[model samples]
Target chain A: MSGNMNLTLKIWRQKNNKAKGELVNYKVADISPDMSFLEMFDVLNEQLITKGDEPVAFDHDCREGICGICSMHINGRPHGPKHGITTCQLHMRSFKDGDTIVVEPWRAQAFPVIKDLAVDRSAFDRIIAAGGYVSVNTGNAQDGNTLPVPKTDADMAFAAAACIGCGACVAACKNASAMLFVSAKVNQLAHLPQGQPERMERVRAMVAQMDKEGFGSCTNTGACEAECPKEISLVNIAAMNRDYLRANLLDSEG
Target chain B: MGVFSFLLKSSIGKKIIMGLTGLFLIIFLVVHCGVNALIFMNDGGVLFNEAAEFMATNILIRTMEIVLFLGILVHIFQGLYLVFENKKARPVSYAMTNGNANSKWYSRSMGLLGTLLLIFLIIHLRHFWYVSRLTNELNANETLFDEMKEVFSLLWVVMVYLLGMISLSYHLMHGFQSAFQTLGWNHKKYTPIISAIGFCYSIIIPLIFSIMPIAFYLGWIK
Candidate 1:
């Protein structure tokens, strides 16, 4: 109880996709600053269960920040007040003693709230399925030395491949645009020799699916890059734009 | 959809159109400001009048004027469409949003600033373009410079012009480099140069435009 803090929480509580949601208030005491944000939620849920009340529902997997499932729009930000982090990676220490926190689900037409702080981000799955991969016949792996990808391209491709498929970029963007997420997927593939066969078609099909998902258009505001947990650069977006343009104008296979 | 329809309907395609038209308008601003600065010569508007006469009568300039109008129309309509779609993307609004945490206020407020500029454009066209080109209201020997002087003389009109210029400044601040980025021109080597040029352009061009109204109203140029 020495450094433990008591806090107030305003959390969005929604029943289901069709139901309306409201921010319900609660209180927690003796919260240790060392606990991860999700652990803090675990404590809250335990408290609710003791009181015979329904616990707040949220999404989480691999609290180590990789699975990209943890999502909480906390205190008017995607993953609390931290930069370049997922909600699971945030710790209770980020808050001051006796602070009031607000948490909500990602609000976008393409990402509907499932319950409480969880949203249905299957839209990203559909986009990936559209063309976020390269097709190759089932055979032995090709020799890595055979295709000598330049150092610069490999580095850029690796950087872009770091995207965790989190919807934080959409949550941070004013337009709720999924450009950062979609572009990351596009650039990761487009930079490698393995992606050359379907580079043009991938950009075209992925963009079409992204638009169909009702996500807003990118305005080059850079919010997505600023808020990305993996620190994915906005350059991915520019590259995707370039690829999409070439696909539309120059690609003869269209 | 075919390529043409894709260009018209796709989200990225719409943005490309916005970027292209925005760059065109940015160039037009430079030319417009350069020509308007001729008033500083203070040669009884003689040089300014000659330049205005040539701009009015030159066949190439006349044709480009039509193209310029079309660009403006496309930019405005496309911008409005994007704003509408963006709003719909998040129909269930957040209870609290701190947009300033990740992006600049002007970058987030492009639609609002652009709307203000549209209002300014209407007043601007009526004051100068309509009087000199579309109407016979000006007597013989009255130049476009005369109309500017008469218009800027009004305190309210001068205030409106100054407000318009401020809005234009913020719009360009976000728009100039944004146009380049949307066009996929972002490069580590060239983007910094583009951003630097954009920053200077956003300030210098709008400053020049603001000075025209202030100079006329304060009797600095007359």
Candidate 2:
């Protein structure tokens, strides 16, 4: 598995959502198995560049899987076949010689293809703008231990905060539901003491924005968690739902 | 939008309706299955008829029938909307799809299962409910159990009922706990217990329902 091998790549080629896309084929020979998946793409791009041809356009940064910019649909699953890892963390060794890999961009309407393998993930940004943060004035720093937060609650909030704003959940979902992504933000704050003041309003507004963005309803298929690079738990969704219900009840009363 | 419209408009809002309506229908199934199971007494439908009469004539239960109909309509309506939205979400088709790895087949095929169940429900209601309550085809003193016997006498009808129950079990397998999850009832200590109860309910309730038709068709009831 550690030897140089030849592989065929069937990548999607679309200038934009308006333009039709097709699977464009390329062959890369003598690839090192130790090379990262994006490195392999780099080699392909280098070849295309030397030949005076257009290089394949895709998104990547912080190849450490943290930035979440390297979003792609490899084969069928998001961020390639391996679980709990981003496309940048994917190595060539996972694939074998002569493997004809099919690569494509996220296909959700909410994440329309921007280029070949990059999608317009601005919908995620819009949802965050709706209310993904606590309202706090910045001045002299408040002590971190001022609230005396519970360790477990802090950890759970950290877990929910691990969402990188990647659109993978939308891509993997059968319904293209953004419940996992929205819930991550919702539950992250739902667990913290500081988040209590705007808890109801945050959940309600974010969900409103998510719906307005044209994402479909979640059916609790659990595919989002299975495909998420951060391994975000489905329990976050339950937390969001709980908050949402209470928020609705309160809103209706007021 | 206002609060109620807001709840009904969002993706999560639509799911809330699906969950709430699904849970409501599940309660109906439990009561229906429990009463239907009474045929096992085999006392020539005397006790079963008494129970059926109480259900049909009781003001409280009669009022609930309207509520149940509304629940079913909302459930079906929201289900269809969710299905359409999901399909539109993924307009570009995958060249090769593998669904088994991520979720159960029943979980993804809920729309198909629900559609089949809708067809079955109409036929079922027409046979017993309409005949028993709406029409004078049977005397007031006549037992509904005898109607069940006559209905299950047909092999095709029994097969339809069994198939409907299969769809129901699969639908409930996902719907039972999914409803709870959508309503945000999932928890660390309680989720496992809820899932186990849902699994058992999905299997046992459908088994009870299918058994009634099977028992009648096979002469086991006699």
Candidate 3:
């Protein structure tokens, strides 16, 4: 193609969690602008394999943006330098022909890098396990209309539920705070009638898990919301705060 | 109680403390600014001294002063604690970060701004609060306003006050709205209004505060 571009990539190459990492440089040529960022990486890996060099290790499950598995802090931004898109959604068109791209894994104490560009985000899975789900007996599905949900409440819950558990919020935050992700989980349930049964306890447990995970406290900088692939609102954080305060102050069970 | 301990221990709980104490300090600034603004009357410190005496002697104000100090201390201690904890969250630093790509510089810089304000507060308290509240060091004839005149006479002191107000401006700019968010007071309809009010408050209060020392130093007020 006439517009095929060549680029320089400085990728963080780490052996394991205990080993030190460094940015190693490589050049990619004749990259099509239509290729997704991950596809571009695939091309680079193919070249490395052909050359008998170890391919750079990164994480990705779905080429589509929904899976939340693809993570790269490209050029100082989580999921590359675009807004409201995951790394898998980022295209080569976002970069110029001569641009130098730097990619690194999400950097946080809770998320130790497993390899070159893959950090163990099991900390997030544990937080979800803590209380991110509602406890309901496994039976036939309850009728949707059985619980009357206000339209506004349903919409708010839906918005909060869009969070795909990607750790971009953590990556983007200067403190590596997971407030945005935790708030999304908390608020998604807090706004639903089914969520009411364990609303207070859920917030408490999830927050305890979040703190235990060694993620930083939020400073309300709105960085997470800005960089979120799902564009999760910071209002979730506020709602989570309200729920947490109520959980601690007004919950009679304690 | 378990709840009290939760408030003291949890991450969200610590932020709630910051937000509540910050709002209290915000209100205190309004009162402090209003009282100090009386010097603008330029009546050789007569009205200003009366207000100052009333503040010192009033039982209600005296009690609130203790509450104010407690609020300030809690705010300071909690802030320092959070800064320490936040630093530990990211053990491995990014090779490059564009924080300005997502949030305002001042929003990310609350700790630094707050530390500057703390330093300013110490100097400010030493200059006026210590002399007026703790000691009989002031000449009997010199009112608190006269003390202000004497203290602001120095170009360096005035410069420090100006720097302090600048820090206060940025700190309040982020803090006012951040407190509301932390307290779970944000709403789509109400938050914009709160943010606008906060923006004006941050600028106006700090501007008035900066003007005080400048007015004294430049003889704009007697």
Index of the highest-DockQ prediction: 3
DockQ of prediction 3: 0.88
Residue A106 miss distance in model 1 (angstroms): 0.3
Model 3, residue A18: displacement in angstroms?
0.7
Per-residue error for B185 in candidate 3, Å, reads 0.6
By lDDT, is 2 or 3 better?
3
Each model's iRMS: 0.8, 1.4, 0.6
Best by TM-score: 1
Error of 1 at B56 (Å): 1.2
Pick out the ten consecutive residues of candidate 1 chain A with the lowest summed lDDT.
A137-146
Q: Which lDDT values do the candidates have, in the order given?
A: 0.92, 0.88, 0.93
Report the error of model 2 at residue A54, Å. Answer: 2.1
* Residues B101-133, model 3: lDDT tens digits: 999999999999999989999999999999999
Poorly placed runs, candidate 3 (over 4 Å): A138-144
- The CAPRI category of model 2 is medium
Tens digits of per-residue lDDT for model 2 on A174-234?
Answer: 8888999999988888898778888889998999898888787888888899889999999
Sorted on lDDT, best first, the list reads: 3, 1, 2
Q: lDDT at A99 for candidate 2?
A: 94
Query: Runs in model 1 with CA error above 4 Å?
Result: A137-144
